[model samples]
Target: MSLPDALAASILSDRQLRPEFEAICDCGGRLAGTPSERRALGLVARLGEAATGQPAMRIPTPYEGWSAQEAALHLLGDDEEVELACYPLLRSVPTPPRGIEAEVVAVGRGTEAEFAALAPELAGRIALVRHEYMFAAGHLHRRLKYEWAKRAGAVGFLIAGPLPTRAVAGSSGRGHEDGIPALGISPEAAARLARTATGHARARIRIATEERPETTETILFDVPGGGPEIVVLSAHIDGHDPAESAIDNASGVAVMLAVARALAPHAGQFRRSLRVAIFSAEEWALTGSRIYLDTLPADERGRMALNVNLDSVAGSPNLTALCSGFPRVAELVEAATREAGIPVGTFLPLMANSDHANFAAHGIPALRLVAGFDDPASHCRHVLTAADTRDKVAETELRAAAIAAAAVTWRALTSTDSLR
Candidate 1:
């Protein structure tokens, strides 16, 4: 058998894939700067060393940290007040003890034109927007909606979750800077706050949070090849506090681990070194990878040939490489998948939604492998909701992702042409 086929077979047969994924899920939602994140990082350190035969290096990363103590939302009416379920978006600035009461305006889907049309009505009011399926094409990010609300002079922001009963969760994209209060609510809560005949509906939002300086670490494993050029294989270890963050990223980390195990032994035969970067705090605006890359010298960054980032790789049977505006990288991925007898799709846009964007901004060709792209029915919709658990990922799906990842990494490691 050919060497790539032999490596793919080894990865498919490796018994640690599912176990490692479940173990990460078992560690609870690995919220950055939390105990849960620490536990998962420790587990990954051991497993990564075992897989790559290299001790994991913990690169210290410091950043502003935030934790929500309490967040409450209530609808105000003439005679009765109704309380609604809500979760605070990460890094949301806390309101006063009594909270801010303001008129609530619903902007449909939070499109730019919608916000523009409602510009006059948004000022001094709380803007409400809908959260769409994230893995689909043309979908808007919550951070963009939040930023629109803030720029429109809105007092606060509310994102109605896509799920029926569960409240969504994600970063507010605001660091330690001044920002409006933000929260995620269920669809039912959004329905109740519709425009009434009398005037815009009024709601009260109270959020209490604490902020401090914190430090975390990004793990790295370097498996040197025969050449100076490097191929970076990366995945984020951090996720939301809701559920297990399974379909969003545990699948990616697991697939990465399995591929590393199967391919590290053959690095000496390849043309590029394989650098495994497992990052934390990715949920907080991709901070982990950004910090790691920013700290490197320009000469060191120039040595990087490509970055193949695995994220949300197995929520569905389908996989697509978000090639970060590099069409040649997409072609390479397609060829690798074809060689392995697996079908993988490609998208030719630069998505700042994952760690790969950090590498792309540095002029390195970077791509993010994701599952269920444009497939709303896929379990990836459950990400950031309470329903995102280990059960949402299937063993076969994870193995398929690992096989494809191994093939791609192997091809990238041995290819003589410039990846960029």
Candidate 2:
């Protein structure tokens, strides 16, 4: 069967989808388990129902929640009051020292090797590590390094943010629940603290974080048909603080809504089932995907032909698709791009960090489609900050992405040939 160009065009031309993007921005920040996150989930379900005429159900998963109670830092003997901004680490130690002061020591980059080199001097001191390079890299390597510093006998951790070329924000992860107080400081504040410390300066950090084990829902909307295979389309419905998450994933959700609208009328036409999954807690270590994978029946797992994941697709000049495990799927994506007149590019190896990771881990073929980094000014900035508002998204880009995704899904569902 050939691809349906008209369906793709219809999906792309739909302007009603803009309200969904606005709703995302209006939510402010949809951190996992927060009210904003719950509202975003409801919005997604409403969109799905409106497009597909089906009720979507929420699937709950296990998670430990933590909120920073009191976060502060005291410079050993500085009489000058230093105003420092700090965020608590995820899953921080249950009990933290309130006013205990220990000597401060600089451990360079705070890498494993660096900590090993400073083991002798760091035994009883608070480890003040420069997080400048780490922040620029978007908290990628900071966690492991912090773990190493903890093992080296550092009483507490003080991460110095990188010099502000652009505004930077900090967030804690599950690792922070290990019972040690972890704090992030602005670069200027860190510099002042570094200058004031003499030979031995006492550094005191206090963190009161609450950890609660709660079960949260993960919603999956499936449209099953009598096809030999299945094409699964996915998008995560969660975001980080300060970011309204309009571009990061709300854009992806809008694309999913458009796809559902384009495919609903022709659901029975294809020889395979089309599944749309709006995942939860994607930003929190792909929690929803992990749980979904574990619960899938083995027999149903093999029926999955391809998993197409849409993430961050609403604002860019060029669109890129990351084909992680399925080379044959890449060929189909190329065909779709050609039909749509959109360019395609290959990405690095699969990180299995998104919702697609769960399906890929079960040996299911998958592809992650996204907008490239060379987008306009509005879309590029405010990645995880407050700048990821609705105004940053371009309606043209969103329409294009939806059309491209529909093209890819149609081809994948109908094509008999396999890329594996």
Candidate 3:
């Protein structure tokens, strides 16, 4: 059956999505194991019950939890010292209680070859690199740069953001044992840390954090249909520790909740059941989704027809479905959106940047709907920073994404061809 126009219209009202979005935003950045993340789980469960007519099930998932208490970076010049604005990378190790001092070295973009060129004199020095535009192609991830610097024997790491005065935020993909003291610094800081006529300058970094095994909950709602097959509409509920995390994910969760409410009426008539998997700790390298998917048995995993992941879906008005190189998935989305009178774009290459990659890795067809695919100047540039707040997205843009998502999900579940 085709998606009813009435159902589409029902989701248009901002009354539901806006408050839900704000509530999630008010919960702070929702970093894993934080009070904010815990509050979000309860709020989402209430929203899920209102949408699905049944209480959402909380699935306990375990992961290593990391949180920062305080972090500071300063450039120690011969005569005058200046403090730099910065944010610590997730899971970074703390420096000595008093901090560590070392000579600073700039490795440009910190690519493999860049590190190789400076390999001769990198030991015991602090490596400085630049963060790239996340939504663009060929953009080097911050983790790769940290690994390269670690291999080159750097004692500490610093990454500069694209925007000046705003220190870029990202994960070092490091643990207390495997990582050096890593922090994200502003471009201005990078400039000051540059070598002067007096040669390389010294820097000091101090960090205080707590690390241990912790458990977070994954909220799940299963609306059963006649068949055994399932279509998973998924999104990550947690985001960076800074800002409202609006563009990075509050937008996605808001869209998912609205869509879930729209589809609940047609629960058993569709060709397949809809399973809502609202996950957490996505900013921590997709840990929540990975653990949940890994727990499914072979037979249950095979029952998963598709995973439609919504993440960072409203930083811009334009939306693109990253289909991970699956031509059939792209075709399905295009046809559905066209049928709905919405012109949504599609990118065929597979990107492991979000939770969808976990599903696709398990051999299930998965695609991530995102905004500002290659547009660098879009509001997505604010993601992972303090600027990813509620104002970055518009109600119209979110409604458009919901329409596109609903159209594609309806087509995927009701199509007779049996999605490849």
Q: Which candidate is the best by lDDT?
A: 1
User: Which sequence of candidate numbers ranks them by TM-score, best first?
Assistant: 1, 3, 2
TM-score of 3: 0.96
1-420: candidate 2 lDDT, tens digit per residue = 444877866876787778777876677577777888878877778888888777787777876665656767767565653446655544545334555567777776677778888899877677777653321123335566567767888777777655342223444344434535677666565665563424765666777766677556676677766675878889887776656888778888888888888887887777788888888767666777877878888878888888889988866756767777577777788877777676566554564546777777888888788775433343544555456677778888888888788888887777756755
TM-score of each: 0.98, 0.84, 0.96
Q: Model 2 residue 11 lDDT?
A: 71
Q: What is the lDDT of residue 389 in candidate 1?
A: 93
Give candidate 2's TM-score.
0.84
On the 0 to 100 scale, the lDDT of residue 370 in model 3 is: 91
Q: Listing every candidate in turn, what is its Cα RMSD in Å to the true structure after a full C-alpha superposition?
A: 1.2, 3.7, 1.5
Off by over 4 Å in 1: 1-3
- Report the C-alpha displacement of residue 405, candidate 2, in angstroms: 2.3
* Per-residue lDDT over 1-420 for candidate 1, one digit per residue giving the tens place of the 0 to 100 score: 123667878877889999999999999999998999999999999999999999899999998899999999999999999999898999999999999999999998999889999999999999999999888778899999999999899999999998898999998999766899999999999999999789888999999999999888999999999888899999999988878999878999999999899998887788899999999999999998999999999998999999999999987999999999998999888988987888799999898899999999999999999999999999988999998999989999998888888778888888878877
List model 3 lDDT by residue over 1-420, tens digit each.
Answer: 455788778877647887888888888888789888888888888988888776788999999988899899999977987899999999999888999999999999889999999987789999999888887667788888999999999999999987758887878886445789999998899999999898897899999988889999889999887688899999998877768888879899989988888888877567888898899988888889999999978898898888899999998988889997778889888988877767678988788899999998998898999999898899988998888999999888888898889888887677545555
Best by TM-score: 1
Error of 2 at 125 (Å): 4.9
